[model samples]
Target: MAKILMITGDFVEDYENMVPFQALLAMGHQVDAVCPGKGKNDSIATCIHDFEGHQTYTEKRGHNFTLNAEFDQVAASEYDALYLPGGRAPEYLRLDNKVLAIIKAFAASNKPIAAVCHGAQLLTAANVIEGKKISAYPACAPEVRQAGGEYVDLQMDEAITDGKFVTAPAWPAHPALLRQLVALL
Candidate 1:
């Protein structure tokens, strides 16, 4: 099994955060979910983002997700891989230098990094996806291109793995996403 680190924050997409965390745990992996300013036992607000015949996804309040690790205590060396869940959080998390640093560390070490939907926002801010091809939420494709990465627009169930990085369009792609991540591990 691998030691995995998942970075998330307030308003993280509900399924994106919860499913990967639990699925990895069920697979006998050691997972530590952390938020920038949160610590062990701390909780982050989550939201449900889903399509409902609207022009865009709808958001509704979801469960309060608990952190099992402290962000400040995270060291990229301690984990075999990294997971970044998408949502409103990445819109802000991308601005955290510390978060970007962690992402860079994983890339430098050639460890597998899995990001979904808006999670690519952090990857862009970290400048780790340049010249790589990946899949992400359709709305975020422009950011990927702007960051010098080729964006592969795909349905929610498809995933793309280019080198050590694996990505999917959105939460609905969890099955493929996790499978790719586990294979990397």
Candidate 2:
């Protein structure tokens, strides 16, 4: 079983993230949900809703994912794969230099890195999509093209695996994306 680490933050797509995680777990892979920090108030930490609209909680596997752990602590060489779920979270994660460094390490080490929706934005920031083919949310098409990646307009019918990178469009394509990710495991 592969040890898959999923990185997420606030405003992440609750359902999109869970489908793949559950599928991987069901396949006998060890999946860990690594997040930035504990949530406040009534907000849940390290959990999201599944596609069926049920709440799914994540098991804490690492200290809060910050600039330090993302870059200096967590080594891409230690994991079989990395997964990034899209939403407003990517918009902020892409700006963190450490996150970018970790992303670059994943690309450099040739580890499988899967992303969806705005999550592909991290690939753009890490400059890992150059000459690669990928798919993201429609709004990010120009950005993907600008980053030297071919952006396809297909739903996640199949995962676009360019080298060690796997990308999908959005929530509607979660099933296919999860299947592809599990196959990799």
Instruction: Give per-residue CA lDDT, model 2, range 1-185, as digits (tens).
Output: 89887777766665556667777878888766655443222232232423454453232222222221232346667888889988667888888877788788878888888998888998898899989988887778999999999998876455677777788887677777776766666
* TM-score (all chains, Cα) for each model: 0.98, 0.78
lDDT of candidates 1 onward, in order = 0.95, 0.72
Error of 1 at 181 (Å): 0.6
For model 1, give the RMSD to the true fold: 0.7
| Candidate 1 C-alpha lDDT tens digits along 68-152 | 9999999999999999999999999999999999999999999999999999999999999999998889899899999999999
- Candidate maximizing TM-score: 1
The true-versus-predicted C-alpha distance at residue 154 of model 1, in Å, is: 1.1
Error of 2 at 112 (Å): 0.8
